[model samples]
Target: MSEHLTIVEHPLVQHKLTLMREKSTSTASFRQLLREISLLLGYEALKDLPLTEIAIDTPLTEMRAPVLAGKKLALISILRAGNGLLDGILELAPAARVGFVGLYRDEATLKPVQYYCKVPADLADRPVLVVDPMLATGNSSAAAVDLLKERGAHDIRFLCLLAAPEGVERMRQAHPDVRIVTAALDEKLNDKGYIVPGLGDAGDRMFGTK
Candidate 1:
């Protein structure tokens, strides 16, 4: 697969994202907006899915119907935050195989440490969409992708609600073949390694956690 980065610029996505970015947006509202925006993001990500024809019965007669080619996709969520994008995408692609990769950054070392990983048995044959709301430092995101790659996931796509330049570059350097899809690409990462003007900690906003 070719390396790509797509910034979704739909009006609806932009509007909901603005509301979510407000400091005063509540957790419930944040979560709701994420679900809605994810639907739009998924649409863009799967725009070019290959199509194949199969025999099918229509209202009047039997005919060949066009359907997605290749095996069903594997939707891999990168722990808690990725769940937000996962849910909406699941609604869009309910037949997709679901999986999760749990990783946390060490406070001192600032490196990702895997805590959990469970994926479909057919992961190697299916294209994978890795979901995470924020791509900040990219260390954890790239690490999660590494785990999937080790499992034989060559066709991988990284999906996020927001992305920082540093994080995008990091992922590009590490996994140039994977496509990166996001609702918005922000300016930069702040001193604390947070996306500047991002929808604050996405997990915190979505789940009301500290």
Candidate 2:
């Protein structure tokens, strides 16, 4: 990956990440941890969200409150595993619009092919955040972004639980303007295309299966 990619490495994020990496962690536990960590990461990811001041009651008196400003956000979950992180972000940004991009890998090409795509209104205006658990080779994630851009989403950001260096590098080269917010960028991808030292198959772990 390019040395230019920025990663959120807060201590709390690291501590939670360790528990998620443990082999003994059950699918249920893993899913719970993923939700918790995703929320934490989303907190940092959305720190720069524009906020407008509004008058509100503070029990004793009316005070100015900060509420999300401008157009509402669009949260796009990159299918299956991304749904795990999507749920937590929805809790944080309930009013945010939702979208989905389903990419199923082709057995022969070993490449992701879009099975389905549905986005919210005003993609040209809203700031869209795409969420997925793992970004390994970058082919699927980059393809997903391409589809979003084609649909008029100019401003985009990617949020992930973990990323492989190769994926990070590819994303940077493919789309340098789009910021990639990840918890950690691991070493490399193994022969079978799994991230080395990764928390196994994220979908399987979250869903409680092989």
TM-score top scorer: 1
Q: Write the per-residue lDDT of candidate 2 for residues 1-210, one digit (tens) a residue.
A: 333455888888888788998989988888888888888888877777888999998879999989888899999999889999999998889999999999966656658898999999789888889999899988889999999999999888899988998888788888887788888989998877778798898888899867
lDDT of each: 0.90, 0.87
Off by over 4 Å in 1: 1-3
- Residue 61, model 1: lDDT of 100
Q: How displaced is residue 100 in candidate 2, in Å?
A: 0.6
* Stretches > 4 Å off in candidate 2: 1-4, 57-64
Candidate 2: residue 61 lDDT (0-100): 98
Residue clash pairs of candidate 2: none
Model 2 alpha-carbon miss at residue 206, Å: 0.6
What is the Cα-based lDDT of residue 166 in candidate 2?
Answer: 89
